[model samples]
Target: MLNPIDLHYEWFGVLWLEEENHFPIIVGYWFSKERSEITQDAILSGFSTWTEIGDHSMIMRMYQSIRNKQKKQDWEKRTRLSLRTIFNSPWNEVSPGLYLIKSRDTYPLHVSAILKKKFWVWLEHTAVCETKEELQAFMQRVHEEHQMEISMKNTKPKFL
Candidate 1:
């Protein structure tokens, strides 16, 4: 789970950071999600686009900012929090140099459509896979799963 302290806050928006090779930097407002879906769709969508380009010159990460639920304007008090949820979450090395991370802290609770309460989520990915064989195995499993889903969708139900 995310830090227990996060329960007191809600997501404010997303912060996108880009690491450029050169010292020069360019920043812009990307997108924001307010009381929106808490799923990792936003992160994965951006990551997919990043992978397609195969851009080694730049690296990108998304951070979600949190704001206190209580209303109080105290200049001395800290009320805002931002964390790299995806990267900071726990990861297990499935294979050598191959890491796997789940998207939620607790399975059923975090999988709900609209969160009634706060829960932790981490973006899943293979942190590192040195060989095409390992990557291929992952891709092949996905393909097989997709095929099964399609087959199930096309099947006619045998009503009694």
Candidate 2:
């Protein structure tokens, strides 16, 4: 099993790789205000405690500074929608098995994978992208290449 700390760092790295100057905002709308308040309090207290610890003060400071700076940036101030909202919006119903790749300097590219009826399968390989356009083009090229390879494999030589 993956440790929570490892997962958190991995997610942070991924977001940083995708957005040069921003961190993702994880939001959850709970039916219970008590739970929400409790969670927020815990986070704020945790931040405060970490700030006091001084061991990782530099990292905390850097993250806080970046958060403040991002809040001031025009693009950062805009309301960001969650992937669930984007994919399951009332206006459209996106098919499952779709994934998105985002880069620090580009838009998000949507990609799909083959899957069994309701089971999720992991990709044998991962895709890399430095930009949104690059990501989309990469996916397209990959699909085309795979198709050509499959065609060649399927075609048998004619015998006399």
Candidate 3:
């Protein structure tokens, strides 16, 4: 019997990590009302609670997570849509099982990237701007949200 590590977050419930494994075996329900997406790595590392993972970084995680969800044959058999098709971009496979998809064109308020673990997976994260100013504003909002979450998690019932 393995003891679950309960991370006190609204979305995340009990996290189960194997004693021998460095990676998490089971990371509880991942849900977020915030527009920004957090990654499993960040969740396991507790970085998600304090810092925002960049869109590019999230994209990599999304790709890897989706690939890990099922065997290649099983995944291909299940859907006609490739990951590239789902991403709606001509993603370059920089290395084996690694992808790179970025646009040089800049558009204000434009949705730059959309990432998800799988097609049916409701959890998705997106990058929403093409400019430094927009990115800064977005990060600011994320920082504020993280701070609020931390404060709420730290709040306890004062039994007088």
Candidate 4:
């Protein structure tokens, strides 16, 4: 099985050509990690970890800095209701398959981006905070709740 590998010197993942004697051309980054596969051309071109940094409002000009920008404006623009936008600043993953997003326009407008992967990906989410404390609390609560539900389902009581 062709597993996605993390890129060197970056916090991202990439799929490289495994064929020996062939250039390790990137295929694509891990998007869903489910049913998503690298396309022929896409494999050649490849993709990096799509991270956002710097002033993403209108693309700021930077001189020399440690942090770098990785947002694909063109791609994000095409995708509607994107978690990241001029309005929404902090959109992050709280847990695996779960994302917590918030924006200034809708202050305290907590939204969730749930990754439903049947074949590829279908993001589904519903609301929290800009603070790390709030985010952590929210995530912990959700995780506990989910565990409880799973436990309940597994423990089938036998009626006397």
Candidate 5:
């Protein structure tokens, strides 16, 4: 039986195979932040993958296969997101105060530049605020400084 601490967060959303109880497959999503109940039935309701462990030698093979597949899928998703961003926005410029952070490829340099001038420099990366107030302030600064209208499309990622 694998300890609960042994599991990783990336696999939290998916089902896991348990080696104990004759390789009984269990489906659950682990909430890492909370540590109250060790075994809760509510958290174990989901779909199950394969859970079959033969001997000690076969355990390694099953573990490796699951880990490899998860990593590959994660990498593919990131690559797709990156490509989408690049296709959407081919040109990007570095602003003076704020670093250009790419989220879905459209580099809102003008908006970011305005934020740097209006807000404290420390707030640039210290927090990724998704509230309406922060985004409105950022857009307002951009419009006032550069006379450019920030569109909703550019600010969707900041909130979502």
Candidate 6:
């Protein structure tokens, strides 16, 4: 049996973030009836890539240290939402370190796709707000997009 509330928000939406680095990484996470499936594809098969370039000089040193072993940069999970990040992806990159930060908040809404196995989504990384007010604005825009989807589904074209 599934909880009514959980079932309703299971299929919210999907977004991907691709960070540019020596070894680029693309992560796609989906929300399923199983919370374990909410990984958004953070699984590790071989080597991992660190997206945030927090302290440029420090990151450079970290890069040097892991340059051979692979997956060097150590990231701070708590500040993924407010750091200075640089996203080279085609999606709308926003802020400096936002790609790593805001990506965490996405937990509220489940993935929007039917994911079978872990895969990569090339959607451009973008976060249009920094503060709560700004986040609300961005969310409002998302809401509008959601309404558009619903509207399209509910309405049908007339045949002459």
TM per prediction: 0.15, 0.22, 0.20, 0.23, 0.25, 0.19
Which segments of candidate 4 are over 4 A away from where they belong? 1-96, 102-109, 119-125, 147-160
lDDT of 1 by residue, 1-160 (tens): 1222222233322334447664423222223234344224455455323222223233222221221211111112322112333223221111112122222333211110110113323222221222346334544543453332211111111110
Q: How does model 5 score by TM-score?
A: 0.25
State each model's CA lDDT, in order: 0.26, 0.30, 0.32, 0.32, 0.34, 0.29
Residue pairs with backbone atoms closer than 3 Å in model 6 (clashes): 13-112, 29-40, 31-111, 80-101, 81-101, 84-96, 84-97, 85-96, 85-97, 91-124
Candidate 5's displacement at residue 75, Å, is 1.9
Off by over 4 Å in 1: 1-127, 148-160
Q: Where is model 2 more than 4 Å wrong at Cα?
A: 1-117, 145-160
Report residue 84 deviation for candidate 1 (angstroms): 18
Candidate number that wins on TM-score, 2 or 4 = 4
> Per-prediction count of colliding residue pairs?
0, 1, 0, 5, 1, 10
Model 4: per-residue Cα lDDT over 1-160, one tens digit each: 1111221122223344446886444434433334333333334464443333334331212211101222222112222243332222122212224333333332233433333222222233232343457545655654564442211111111210
Q: Return the lDDT, model 3, position 105.
A: 39
lDDT of 6 at 25: 30
Candidate 3's residue-wise lDDT over 25-93, tens digit each? 454334333333325544665744533334565434543454345223321232233444434322221
Find the 10 residues in a row with the least total lDDT in model 6: 151-160
lDDT of 2 at 87: 32
1-160: candidate 2 lDDT, tens digit per residue: 1112111122111011224567534231112224345345545544322112223554345455553453234212223233334333321332333232222232322222221112222221233333557555655654554442211111111100
Better of 1 and 2 by lDDT: 2
What is the TM-score ranking, best to worst? 5, 4, 2, 3, 6, 1
Global Cα lDDT for candidate 3: 0.32
Query: What's the alpha carbon RMSD for model 3?
Result: 19.8
